[model samples]
Target: MRMNPTFIVMMKCSEEAGVQNPVFQRLYICLGALKKGWKEGCRRILGLDGCFIKGFHTGQLLTAIGVDPNNQMYLVAYALVESECKDTWC
Candidate 1:
């Protein structure tokens, strides 16, 4: 299978930015899809929430956002928060 240049570039960029592996490839795809879909239509959101993983203590942090309309999933955004503020997740 052919490798994606964006992943390669993102991995290198992440390393340079001091971010660890298992990086933001999925979120990147979601963002790219959203960008493409914007020309088609705008996505509406009903409710959004974030979930935690990797136990209470870990190397990196994660938060998930979902963009939905009429119970249909459209887009998602994930953030790696490095702060203690659980409410202020991206």
Candidate 2:
């Protein structure tokens, strides 16, 4: 589906809201992007910060992995940690 001005890429509900399910539409869009270009030269050292939740629990330190332009091992992966550790992260 062509992206309209009001098309929501993602949503929390399964039921249709404004237009044909925004979530599905967004999924399709993402899939299209993936198909358009394969992951290459995207790997790089990934640095991530902690992420918190909305519950009765303390915030969590997490990491995110991604590639760089040179396809080098960027942020490898995200792991829950007690605190921020730069040396341990990279």
Model 1 lDDT tens row, 1-90: 144332211111124455556333222123555444533554543334445446654323343334444445554434444333643332
Looking at candidate 1, the ten consecutive residues that score lowest on lDDT are 5-14
Give the distance in Å from residue 50's predicted Cα in candidate 1 to where it truly belongs.
0.8
TM-score attained by model 2? 0.29
Q: Give Cα-based local distance difference scores for all models.
A: 0.39, 0.40
The regions of model 2 sitting more than 4 angstroms off are: 1-41, 68-75, 85-90
Name the top TM-score candidate.
1
